[model samples]
Target: MRKQKCGVIIIAAGYSSRMDGFKPLLKFGRQTAVERVVALYQQAGVDQIILVLGHREDQIRPYFDNQPLDVVVNENFAEGMYTSIITGVAHLNDEIEAFFIHPVDIPLVKRETVKELIAAPQQLSKGIIYPSFLGERGHPPLINIKYRSAILDNKQGGGLKRLLALYEADAADLPLIDEAILMDMDTRADYQALLIYDALEAPNLCECYAIWEKHKLPENIRRHCQKVKQTATDLVAQLIDKGETLNRPVLQAAALLHDLVKTEKNHAVKGGEILRDLGYPKVGAIIAVHMDILVDADTAITESEILYLADKLVKNDQLIDLAIRKEMVLNTYHDNPEALKKITRRYHNAEIILQKIQRIIG
Candidate 1:
């Protein structure tokens, strides 16, 4: 089968009334909001991109002068976003099979999300595909070109969302691990939060919880992970006071998701694979070694070491002494000599990390 020709329509014709600054020109990292959204689709190998501009058409138009995309001015953009949507759709090429309607304010939507939506199995069958995170639908719905006329003829009061709602039977929701799908820069405070979120390479607190809910982690395991997160963050705080630089978000997320696949064999490695697949290699690396991390004379107090030690210190949902935790493990595996040796090695590794942390914090 041949690949579908996908395109994206980015609506950047808004007044930025709620936001003190122009949403498209705002900086997310080094790139402007409009630049990032355009880059996202470009990187996803979009066939044709139609950028509909209106509010500050001339000012924003120059930014894409050399870029390979069609930029159309939405003359009636001040009327509403629906006008911009139809303006963008009208410019889509005849050969484009499906297209995504994206708002410029939602610049942080992951590249993987676009690829996932485009490559969805129901792309041909479904008229609309909504990217959902934690059961909430979000920006940039992928619409089949067949609905080009419907979007152009949309006279509904609730905008694009309500117009799409009319075709519920023809739509399907594609659940994604990305929390950025639900994030938008509506206000200054929202933009500030997104800036902080963009700084971290790992998943944020909300995404971590969403992962747990998606995997259906049991209540007991959830409580244990919560305790581990508290213990790990507390350690991070003390260590930072001692002038130790650490990635707190990475550590916290790794600690919470360390036992993600506890029921599976080699759960540490399995959990790591799961997280890495979800676009979090940093957190996955820490969880991968949470069960049996290598500790040596040169081993410093790293995030992996901190997570490993934190896991050992917590039994179930309670923080217990390492010595007591080690005893309980040995007692459970006393009958198997090989298992006992492995357990001893793991406890010894934890001790090395604990001593390293204690030496600095004390």
Candidate 2:
């Protein structure tokens, strides 16, 4: 029972009346046309992407033969896209925090854009989140699971647009989403026009990381951050194994930059304040918990702890044993017995955490 924050329903059932035939099967780049959309959803790490198919299930099924995907055919596709939308939600089974509805023709959607959209609802105070481009509403609108019953039993003529019209304010408008959200290939011109979007280019994830790393951080700290990032990644696998949280990247970045503001003594606390001032409130919040128990014990093996533990294991740029690591931390912070005890306790906790993480890395 893997818990997920978002589920995607790809409405791929509509007949491409303008492309003459097989528009979803058209190729634009690395994968096929429909495949591009599927790849985006897969990259976004959604709980599940139910591809609502019709017209040619055999042809569509061939592309995902080796891929793990959920495919369902809409027998009533002739009725409308809403029929397929209803069909896909049936398999969701309370397993998602939100539902993201997409159309397969909108293939150029970026993974980072989807990730930001998925995270907005939980990160914001309003409770629900949606995507828009240049102030206009866009596709793959994310609906929170709290409204599951209304969406499930929507009698507004089986049209999602109608349901949206009823309560437009329930959505959060995200202006930063890429143009792909507004581009669906219903005609030949639309299909040909999709060749321009490259969210993989500037201002996306890789770009963000590039700019983020440009703070001129120290080499030793950077190397240590990377190692802790690896360990935090390993921890995510462990937590997922135990049916716990699968928070992606949050712990990784937190682990990497826990000691970001390393001066001489109060680096952990200082680092948190700096990250906060730098518009990384999430990272700062996580880093601030290094010296305190902001969350529970299990989650205490959190970003800060992951960073602290990862820092402890480093000796002259190499990973060392827990005892030696603990001894080093004790000596480094000789004035603080409490930090030593907490570090040691965390190492004691890492025995189980490391063993579990090794299952995936090893």
Candidate 3:
């Protein structure tokens, strides 16, 4: 099938009055928010991007000197965000089949979420496609070029919202599970919270599933991961019930991704490396020891221990006795004495950890 050429329209023309600072220049994590948003679309294979600058064109234009995006100044930017949208749309490449319109403040939308918006036009072929997380609609709505003329002509008053209302019946809402879609930094508090939020938020589950599919994870492995996540969550509930504090998001994500690179040797190590590369160090730490965590029974059970113990208790998706799981591992490597020896050590470590868990929660 021929791929549609999609363009990104990033509206950076607002004054950012609520934020009390220039949002485009603000640091989201390592890079400015504008750079992050552009990188997201670029990583998603967007054909091109048209960045609309208004309030601080000179200040913003220099930032993208070497970047791969079209920077167009909006003289009417002070009017509102709608003018920026119109300004960006006016610069869309003639060949672009669809374009995504979002703001610079929303920099954390996942690559998969953008791809989903881009794909909506091919299937629906008309109207607007908006990404919804939980129940809230998200930015960077992908609009078909078919509505280009209509959008440009609707200068009546309501901006993008009014433009979309004209074709309300034709709008397509693609449900997504990405919390990043529902969040945007609008105030100083929001920005401050975003820094901490970005540091702790796990990679979207949709993106996790995409990675699993991308690696062609076998159905059994996928099921095993799901079961492990369920087991881990149950343990977490128990810990919380006993007034134990834990980072549930990190634990859940680690469980879901403990075997990310399962086909590779030392998959736990490889998975940890992958998560860290993807900017999830905390989750990566837990996944790193899922196969053989060093648990100090003297200390309380930690997230890493929970993941490790849960993994040992699940074999091919079904909750199995730890002894049976260890036997299966040993039998599989019976011919290799050295491998059997390693398995014995792993089993012994798991037994010790299990005793600690029972002592704490039971």
Candidate 4:
């Protein structure tokens, strides 16, 4: 079968009103969001790309000078996103058989998703192909050039969704099961969440250990971390045996770095900050909550819970029961009412997590 040529249209012309910062200029891992989006399609072997730059085009255009990409200016960018789409579609390569519309804000989409979206259409040669994760549809939807005329003629102004709705019955919702497909940085909270999510999905476990060593985490703290890692991995193994899915690298890294700054006051929160600064937001998030596991009876066990419970199980590198561990904590903080209250809350959360684990494994 002859290979179909695919092109990509990246819409980076929005005002980014909700993001507070320009979406295209935002950092995703080491590269800017626009750079990451372009690299993703390039890695997938897309024939060509058309980046529609509008908002702050002067600032955005300079970043791509070192890269090979066709950049187009959407003069009507302030009007709405659909105009950017129109500008991109107008610039599509004449020989391109299919193209994907990717918004600059929805960066970090996996390369495999790009491959799958392109491959499915090449085989079928009809209908629109969309990537879905957990029943939610996400960006970079591939469209057959047959709809090019319809898309260009869309002046009704319902945006891309309205254009897509016109062909809903013929669209194929392909499930990619990637959360990055649904993740978009629209607010500070959303950006923070994306950082945490990206770190978990792509954690640098080696750097995590290097940070621990550079800080010269005390030998005792290191031993405790090693023990917690063992305990958490064991629990994770059991959970996996029962068909539970989780990121092993993230779990191990979080367990090892949970006490990174053990000698500091409020080490748990500080440790989280250290990890976040070190570019290990997922590890930091788990470490931040380890000291006070937020137990939600309704929610399933998370890596944070695994790390918290495992830490509770180990007392100075020795596995101990909850009662014994609580006794040790109380003995240390009994004189300080505030410290005692914090310990009480931590244990309360630990108890709930323990119960949930028991139910899962048994």
Best by TM-score: 1
Please give, for residues 1-362, the per-residue lDDT of candidate 3 as tens digits.
68899998998888899887889889976789988888898899999888888887888788789888898989998888877887888888889988888899987787867877777767876668888865568887888889888877776887787778778888877876466776788998888866776776576566577567556778888999999999999988988888888988889888888998888999999899878766678888888888876766688778898898899999889999999888888889999999998799888888888897777689
TM-scores of the models, in the order given: 0.94, 0.54, 0.69, 0.59
TM-score of decoy 3: 0.69
Best by lDDT: 1
Error of 3 at 120 (Å): 2.7
Error of 2 at 291 (Å): 40
Candidate 4 global CA lDDT score: 0.84
Model 1 over residues 1-362: C-alpha lDDT tens digits?
A: 57789999999998999998999999987899999999999999999998999998889988899899999999998899999988989899999999999999998998888988988845446878999998889978998888899888876678888888888998988888788898899999999988988888788888888889888999999999999999999999999999999999999999989999999999999999988887789999999999887887475579999999999999899999999989998999989999999999999999999889989899
Tens-place lDDT digits, model 4, residues 1-362: 66689899999998999977888888867899898898888888999899999989999899889677799999998999899999999999899998999998788787867887888865655579988865678887898888899999977778888888889877887766356787788898888877776666334444455566558788899899999999999999998888788778888988988888888899999988876765567878888988876689878788999999999999899999998899889999889999999898888888898888889999
> Residue 349: error of model 1 in Å?
1.0
User: Which regions of candidate 3 fall more than 4 Å away from where they truly are?
Assistant: 204-248, 255-304, 310-349, 355-362
Provide the lDDT at 114 for model 1: 90
Q: What order do you get sorting by lDDT, best first? A: 1, 4, 3, 2
lDDT of 4 at 47: 94
Ten residues in a row with the worst lDDT in model 2? Answer: 199-208
Q: List runs of model 1 lying over 4 Å from the truth.
A: 121-125
RMSD of 1: 1.9
